[model samples]
Target: MHHHDNPPQSVPSSPAYIRATWGGTGSVEEASAAFGFSRAKGYDLVRRGEFPCRVLRIGRSTRVVTASLLRVLDSGEPEYSGTRDAHTAPA
Candidate 1:
């Protein structure tokens, strides 16, 4: 048996679902899950100021901009970069 205080929610990687969640703001964990990374990696990106999307920080909490997340997903690119990397670059 397992007991958890706050269990992770299923975050669908759909634009419609994202647009409807939290009125345009989501937690770092949710964003990370959608991006296929661990929550710790997401927070590490935030701490290092390298997160792919725009973030709103207040006190000790961080929130990812829904629009930015959507942009990253829809465009297949990180918001911070104008050029694609080796994985996405042309041959």
Candidate 2:
């Protein structure tokens, strides 16, 4: 008989779960997963400075503002204007 060393990985949580659990804000990974994006792709977007929503970088941690995400979801338009300065974190 074949033996498995590791168990199957659990499925990623849904957007509704992230919204319900995180409320007004969430990690970039969670937001990306909610939008059906892989964590690597999400971070890649942030690294390339091409993320379409408001991303706040607190030290090394990145958060996605739910209000801005909601706005994008509602209007189907990204708030980014191709300006790196626009993505600066608050002081």
Candidate 3:
């Protein structure tokens, strides 16, 4: 018989992990996880223009600005300015 004695590792916060891995930008999924939101809900928020920060649309790709995410995390208030580019399109 053999016994396993490995301890469980502590999980890092979503925002911290996203910031470390993605640097200045991250996907909407990452942003949603950072704020403890479901991926579906996150997409819904973006679609309804109710996301906490500005969501950028590049082609079919959607990315969240890390600066804005960090700001909202710090201040607990959204600062969206409704700056959608011509190329902006929903995912």
Off by over 4 Å in 1: 1-11, 81-91
Listed in order, each prediction's TM-score against the native is: 0.69, 0.64, 0.70
lDDT leader: 1
- lDDT per model vs. reference: 0.77, 0.70, 0.75
lDDT of 1 by residue, 1-91 (tens): 8878885664575676787665678999988888889999999877666688878887888888898989998888877431333343323
**What C-alpha lDDT does candidate 2 achieve relative to the native structure?**
0.70
Comparing 1 with 3 on lDDT, the higher-scoring candidate is 1
Alpha-carbon RMSD, each predicted model: 8.9, 8.3, 5.8
Instruction: Give the clashing residue pairs of candidate 1, or none.
Output: none
After TM-score superposition, the amount by which residue 53's alpha carbon in candidate 3 deviates from its true location, in angstroms, is 1.1
User: Which of 2 and 3 is ahead in lDDT?
Assistant: 3
Q: Candidate 3, residues 8-71: lDDT per residue as tens digits?
A: 4434434555566677778888788778899999898877777898778789987888989878
